[model samples]
Target: MTSAIPNRIRAYLGWCPMTGAAQHPAPDQPAGAKTGDLADSGGSVTGRADRFMHLTIAVVVLSYVVAILILPFLPEVIPVHWNLQGKADGFAASIPGAFGLPVIITLVTLLFILLPKFDSRYAGFALAKDIYAIILFATTGMLLVMEVIFLLIAAGYDLPVITIIPVLIGFLFIILGSLMPYIHRNTTMGIRLPWTMKSDDIWKKTHEHGGPLFMAGGILTVIGSLVSGIWAMALMLVIIIGVTIYISVWSYRYAKTAG
Candidate 1:
């Protein structure tokens, strides 16, 4: 039984037990083609994807470099935290405030890049490579944007944080919503709930519903920001929480009925 487990795992992973070779279609082969008849099928797609990934990494790294360069120019105290009203309420030493946030963002970008390799459900990641790439780019891009905004604020730029932040957030939600439907079931990403993880159909349906909801909420958030920043933040939070709960319950119900 102990030895049987390894074989089972290998089989599940589409690996040859004897040769320890991948049993899946080669990257050069059509999805349903015989493994032996390989061609350079996915090379162009892979190359474009790699270029995008590299571009995202470079942008994130450049953001960090900008932060480091501006560190000396920033005041000893900098606004490190904001209130619901989008007012800078918390202050910290410039060294930590300016440098720490960029460091954390760098670490987060690294984590996002490495997570797929460590995920047991990496096959799902491969299937949803486009979705994964969008997620990576969106998240890293948001961080870079935020870093630049903070740096500008530190440099005495009176940018309208209250309006800009909400607009940025709204755009982010729109991007995420647009891409959410393409994401596949994966343990390391997406709206992972017990039911959604267990049922592919549930995952698909929930994200389908979720995408539109998020888009609507994001639009409302942007409008609210113009009217009332504090209210916009509150409403955005409500929308997110409400959608999450609704999806979780919906997944559960769908799973139960299907079962």
Candidate 2:
């Protein structure tokens, strides 16, 4: 999944995040619906759940309000970056530092908003629309929490960001793992490995295998962060890298053995 296609065409007709620029709708689409919209025939909960997605803008505004409140108290230069040991190393001028997260969050929210429209499996993306909304809102909430904490730090509150961040992230992964099994493969999100690209059965099995592993890793990350903040962050990175490699290999092997 990558920047392999011109975004304009990708948004209109849609293209998988990886593989190639060209794509076509599923051949078996229902007479009056797209491939995944078969569920919409049964009175989908997606519409009710979609309110969470709309709530993201409200969360974004809260971050901006927080930044405005905290700006007057922040020093002329604030620590915008931190080292593994939680030491503030990177610095930025006050105004930019104060509003940093709002700008970043606004851009990220917009990008997420556009990603689904660009997804080649546009219909499949809606298969688990409830999960997607929760995932999106939860992720945005996590970032909002970070923005609040960072602003507090900039306002001279003493906090261990290195430790706090890992715990929060670990929980997020757990939530993702629990919900991941329900998501169908989509080019713009989730696992898009070559083997997963092969078939729906492979994609389904891969996520089923991966869900528990993701939760396990999250548990380890929480434990690691609590026991040793700095080393835990290092271990967290290693776990992420290691898990991705392991999952890719696992999908490949499973794909090979499947009939």
Candidate 3:
């Protein structure tokens, strides 16, 4: 009965059951299709999804190009670090700061693109490819926002770094939270606690509970950002950390009871 639990949960979640070595698709197999016949039927859906992925890559490339074009006009030393008080405390040479960060963002975006194809649990990833794509796009957009923030500071804008950081983080949390429930259980992402990993039901339930909690926390964070000083940062951290602990404990207890 315990062993059968995962399959039941997978069924409830509308995910295909993994079949040992055959879970991974063949080199020529179309994703999420059972056979070539089904693949042909699903071709249009797959093609549309691929086009969205291509568009995301194009956006990343365009953002990088814009960053590079602005590089030469920045000051010799750029602000690279900020304190809780919103003051710049660390600096880096404009050339490396401008170029290197965008390079790193591009590499990270490439990794996100490759992850679904290369992860050990690619089969599970394929099951949730649409959600994965949305997550990837949101993360890449966040990185681009960070790049823009750096560029704005480098260009001598009097932006409120400390407040902006918290609000952006809150927005990111809200985005992730909104999508968390759709994320299938996989080793490469999501709340990967031992008990959650052991039980599919627990993973689903945890995310179901966690998703709302995260959104609430994110709201609190955004509200906190309106206040100056370390208090806002401290409150945001407490909310995030508190939710994490709550979900882990809840998942463990739920799993134990189910067992």
Top of the candidates by TM-score:
2
Off by over 4 Å in 3: 1-52, 228-230
**lDDT, each prediction:** 0.67, 0.72, 0.67
Among the numbered candidates, top lDDT falls to 2
What are the per-residue Cα lDDT tens digits for candidate 2 across 1-259?
3565555443432222122111222323322344333333222335424456667788889989989888899999998888877888999998999888888888888888788888877666765555666677778888889988888888889988988888888888887777666667777667888778668888888888887788888888888889885776787777777777887799889999995
* TM-score per model over all chains: 0.77, 0.82, 0.77
Q: For residues 1-259, could you state the per-residue lDDT of candidate 3 as single tens digits?
A: 9869976644333322122112323323433553222222223324424544665686678676867888877999998877766778988898877876668767877887666665665654555564555566667777777778878988988877777778878887887787677556666668878887776678778887888888888888998888745566666778789988887888888888988
TM for candidate 3 is: 0.77
lDDT of 1 by residue, 1-259 (tens): 8899976654333222123212222222322332233212233323434555776778777876888899878988999777777789988898788876678767877887788887766555565554565567777787778878888898798877767777778878877776666566777777788887776777778777777777777787777677875566666677667766776787678778977
Q: Predictions ranked by lDDT, top down?
A: 2, 3, 1
Which lDDT value does model 3 have at 161? 70
Relative to the unseen true structure, what is the C-alpha lDDT of residue 245 in candidate 2, on a scale of 0 to 100?
81
